[model samples]
Target: MKAGKLAALGAALLIGAAPAWAEAPSAAPGAARIADTATDEARLMALFRDDARREDALDPLALIYRGTAPDPAALRRLFTDSQLRAQRGSVIQSLALLRRIDRRRLGAERQISYDVFLAAKREEAEWLRPDSIALTAVRPFNHFGGLHIEFPSLMAKDGAVKYEDSADYRTNLALIRAFPTVLDNAVARFRQGLASGVVESRLTTANMIAQIDALLAQSPEQSPFYSPVREFSAGIAASEQPALRAAYGAAIRDEVLPAYRRLRAFLNDEYLPAAREQVGIAAMKGGPGLYRRYAGRQTTLPVEPEVIHQLGLAEVARIQTGMDQVKRELGYGGTLKSFFDVIRTDPRYHPKTREELARGFAEAARQVDALVPQYFSRLPKTRLAIEPYPAYREKFEAGGSYNQGAPDGSRPGVFFYNTFDLPSRFLTGITTLYLHEGAPGHHFQISLAQEDASLPDFQRFGGNNAYVEGWALYAETLGYPMGFYKDPLQHWGTLDDEMLRAMRLVVDTGLHAKGWSREQAIDYMLANSGMGKSDATAEVERYIAWPGQALSYKIGALTIQRLRKKAETALGPRFDIRAFHDQVLGSGALPLPILEAKIDRWIAARKAG
Candidate 1:
């Protein structure tokens, strides 16, 4: 669900420049115990600020997202071997610096900041370890992930990259000119992957090959990288417009196109055929351990694959029961298997046109938007825009996804509803889908977090996937409290979406850990849920391409729900839904353990009061 192209890769939203001293004046942590208390405190904060700046400076994409111009060379580069080594060394140095900070002397909020900082640095250092860094930093892309998908998206007028002025055009043109270098870096990384015997699945490689083939089929004027040149604002001089356009167009033809052509040849002739046929990562060398690392990073929890698999199975059963009851209410006397077949074939449950699909999402958003004030005290200033995936990218996109808006609320957050192969899309899932991806789901959690200047930049722009995705998953249930889902079908939509998440737990672990085949995973989804074969196949492939990520949704939602129940049980009448929500949204995203601790303290504070 946390999908982005190149921009997504820059999601290392660090603890931004330390909270202003004037805002939260407190004694330096552990300062009293040290000979130079004040000096230690100043050193700690200065380190935090310096590290954040270093990362931003190195990341051209992050700077672009922050609405600032970066060195044009940033567009041409991602990671060189030397830069990667330097970055690793920096993380190691930062970790050492962090360890010297005294936690006991910090104020209440600063203590939380310290803990968050420690966990982030520790995680960074762990990933930087020779074994971990080599495995991950190489193979910088799957068929779905690499800059191949992102570069095109970012260059569009609507994307994160800006092109308002002549200088902006030149900056982008510089990036385009440097794209050959970017592709070379990717090829070098892929070669390292090939050498290490750490290649992606053939499925992933084949799809990547096809992506390049599709793009290469386009005309130079129509190239993804050439999109920005087509739209010239008044900021660009009329005489200079044609020249900039031709330059970018030729860059795509001479520079960008050939880079992908080489990539296509390498993948088609070498990598794909040499890649492992097995869908699971466990079959690769040192795969079992590597898979665990992925799982840990995605979930931020130490729970094993088997534990998640079992939890998924239980949740799947619970959701199935709900589905059966709803089926019974609808007076369908058939078994659940028959029900699945019925919905799949039933035209009424399928949208006839893409416009209808978009309209349905619009209505769902309107209903949720109207009821927003009743459920929470704070709402996002950023508006939510519903749109379909662009034609070129639609085939590969899942049913729908949400992208974060700009922090200042100028650009609206988008819920991209996939309209490809409309017959394969389900109408029953719309209400729940909107709740999960639109108004109260990603749009709220991400927008509110980014908009809040009170939180550090790291908390706003980056955090754990579980908290973000889990909050979205939990938002699906809010449809019930908001007085939607009254229709039996809409109620079933919620169950279907819940079942989708539950199935992910089983299928993700099953594919990666239990050695389940692609066919077997798709079949299981079809049997257990309302998914069409096409949708199920795409979802399974997503898990195969990106391992361990699928497990976060249900695991995260369940944790949040359990904590909410605990708070509700203890607070009774004192539990203000508004305040509890504000607290959760107020701090942005947190690791699960940190989130649990924060909630426990809140409960204790409420009890004391």
Candidate 2:
């Protein structure tokens, strides 16, 4: 879901490769160049804030998401090769500046910042490699997590962009007008992929083409892009609304829809024919190495695909035992596979209507909110809102996803649940899904960091998957102490959700690493858990479109669980669950190793006290 790109001459600074800049020069023992720990730390923090501002300047959408006003001029920047080079250069320079700080001289808090910033820059450096860019930048968008899908949602009335005043509407109109250029640049990138034999999978290509077709089928008035002008904010004069409406309608009709048609035509005519039949990145020119980098980046460790695949298989077997226990408690006489079938097809286990589904999640949130303080000491100030995926995007979306709100709490963080194919949606996963995507999961972790002004900008707003998603997955386990899974069916639901993550470990690796077909991945999912066919298909396709991301959930949960167990054992009677949680989340999302080290320090401090 996250995206970023560098040059061949700078290959020495690639991830895992040591760059010369990292070794801060040692001052002579007799020299007067003493380390100013406070001054250095202040300088470092200032640099972090400055660089974050620079990053926000380049990415107006980021500013919009962060609740900061954006410059209209920056909004027109297209997705071009020159832009990619500039981003890479900025990262390389930032990393150089970061390494100049003597990390050991700083206090513990800044040291954590120093390490996290350095690691993120290194990861960015690797991703920007010319070869990596060729494989990735060339395929700028896909069916899932692509800008084509995300932009519309972001521009919606209830979405991230502000709609308070005439200028706000004008800024949004500029964004809408600039979209065609972005889409055209994507076509250009796809052509580059085709010429270089780094094309996307045929399956994803078809899905993307279908998505574009769906957008083109709608009139400008019905389009999500035009929704903003349908009603102007109270701040806008009534007389001004007509001109804004006409401008929006004309932009969508003349520019946006035609651009979608051009993209769709190119995919149908040129790109689809040239797309790789194999879904895994391994089939492409530099796919294997790219997958390895993705695996490392997603997991935040240099773990091999086979190792992750084996871990997934072991987890699937273990979670199946839990599912069997739930089945026995339910007094089901059938085998686990049959039980899965029953859950999949039974109307009682599925939602009857979209409103019913919404109510289910709403009730789940209400229950979890009451119980949150018992487990977590600090909560997110930003309110959480539950909504269904817009009609345009639900088909390609996962069952649920979290979109963070403004750090200042202007916009409420949204947990979007897919209501497409309502009959196929399960009620059992509601509580578990809410726990992961809402409170004590993403909302808690993201909001807490951004709200704390004490941390550097990178630490507050930036994060890796293993920590962010891992924390959410681990949060799902808290349902036990909170007592929401008392029902036999709900217990099975949590296990099934856990099984989904476990299956991702298997299915993702199987698809990308072991030459498993899409059908094979979907079949593997169906045989293991109670996921419906349609949901299973979507999950498999998600992994295909974005490799190694699924692997993060289980891997991250395991790391956090292991650390908790270690803390419990070491501190014995002194162990405080709330305090342990505070320690885990207090520093924001970290690489797995950095997180472990942070926890170890906390345990040591507890023992000494």
Candidate 3:
């Protein structure tokens, strides 16, 4: 039930540069075999280092444009068409590989090693924050360079990476320089309550401050961040890169720390205090216009907000009617609402342990895979595994999400479930979420695109909220009537999930655009759907923080449904679900307009044949 403007937060977290590296040959059998040899360890290290450098690389143009308004003419010259295309291309491959590794390592006994790898990453990031390398490369005045903050540390204990004391000083120095601008923008955005207020939930907002406070509270030497800087400095020393290392230290001490102090002071004094207690976008100024833009971006469609609002209202009506039909079919005379009530209170959906909850999802994955060939011809090269969310982050997640694999088969896709509160991991939504996050949803779409090496990297990896999420939401319905949910309870569960998305439209718009208070949104959810108080509250807060994003789920699902129906109507007897799926996924991900064009082309080709 995330309610924050996730789009803004999501974009903010992504920072780094790519170290230019010579291209490696394809992942042929020979190359893989060589990778496994003891001698190849050096090669692996070199590759990892190169990958590390690549992560921090920034577009020089983006750096230049920061703070200054974009000069369309000047900006045009700063980036070539090819460079932008290549950057997008690289994103696809990088994300694919990243997802691949997570999927493969999930649940293995040696999974601790993956933690070590991540720990190493934390350390490296710390080094890059304030070290000579970061200081020289990262423009202190710009947000694009230097380091980026992340959710939290996933690793709990000492691992392969030795912990050192002096890391935060170096990193904080680099990070703080940009803090003034970032915090100022956040504050300004919050102040401008137009198109939904930009305020976040006090709890989550507090968490943001806490994250910074934790760092600031630490001694420069004893900080979790400082360890990385010291090691990086030592590494450079051993390599006799004394000049580079010294230069990095001076930049961190001089330019970065002051900026951090400024942001910290602002959060404590201004932003956090003004944070709203309300969760949803409702009651905010001009919520409707904001939600409309959110809807447009989420769907990648130009559909008007009023039209979408009406569509959502209609869908809710339609779905409720269908639920009644289901009840009548089962000879249950009670109202459709009663059936929903019965299912919510039922114990059959409850799982006893974290493992069972996860296994339930894994089982669904298996079930979907078994049925894959029946409706879809193409499969992703990337494999997906179901895993519990990492402890640090799970507390905040209501639903599971897909962790895409690396494109080069260096990683596997992962579906991370929030197994913290078992009851909230409602059984009814399990199958739908699996399909949405795994199987023919995110897992299939993301990995398939990544696997397509010929596509531009950005096209594969680059995301449009509407296309990716829409495809997955659409996938939820593909197997719904195929007897996937044989049990009445399970069948109800499927509908419940569908209704949840449909409801998102009403509540999302209601809160963000209609001036419905947070309490109003929560009550609406509780009354219309079987959402628990906790889940409902979290969700409402998420919507407030992130205006219009909630609308994407149902909107995307509906678009895909319409498209599939188009295919069905056009092809009739020749229609193949699997073929249709393959075609849809084969193009990787594109904006809805591009997706429509591609699909139309496919339809034409099939008709011609």
Give the whole-model CA lDDT for all candidates, comma-separated: 0.79, 0.83, 0.54
Per-residue lDDT over 533-586 for candidate 3, one digit per residue giving the tens place of the 0 to 100 score: 667776776666566777787765655666677788898888887877776676
RMSD list, candidates in order: 6.2, 5.1, 14.7
The worst-scoring run of ten residues by lDDT in candidate 3 lies at 151-160
lDDT of each residue in 1-609, candidate 2, tens digit only: 001000111123224643443232343221123234347787577668757866887787777777655775566565687777667756765765665577777899888888788777777776777766888889887898888878888887877889999988987888888888888888998998888888999999999988888888888898988888887788999999999999999999899889888999999999999999999878878888888888888888777798778878888999999999999988887899999999988899999999898999989988998988888899889999999988888998889999998888889999999998976789999989999999889989999998988988878888888889999999999998899888887888899999999899899889888899999999999999999888999999999999999988988888888889889999999998999999999998988888877888999998999
Number of backbone collisions per candidate, in order? 0, 2, 57
* TM-scores, all models, native as reference: 0.92, 0.94, 0.63
TM-score of 1: 0.92
Which order, best to worst by TM-score? 2, 1, 3
Comparing 2 with 3 on TM-score, the higher-scoring candidate is 2
Is candidate 1 or 2 superior in lDDT?
2
TM-score of 3: 0.63
Q: Write down the lDDT that model 2 would get.
A: 0.83
Candidate order by lDDT, highest to lowest? Answer: 2, 1, 3
For candidate 3, give the lDDT of residue 10.
24
Can you give the lDDT of residue 405 in candidate 1? 76
Model 2 pairs in collision: 5-128, 6-128
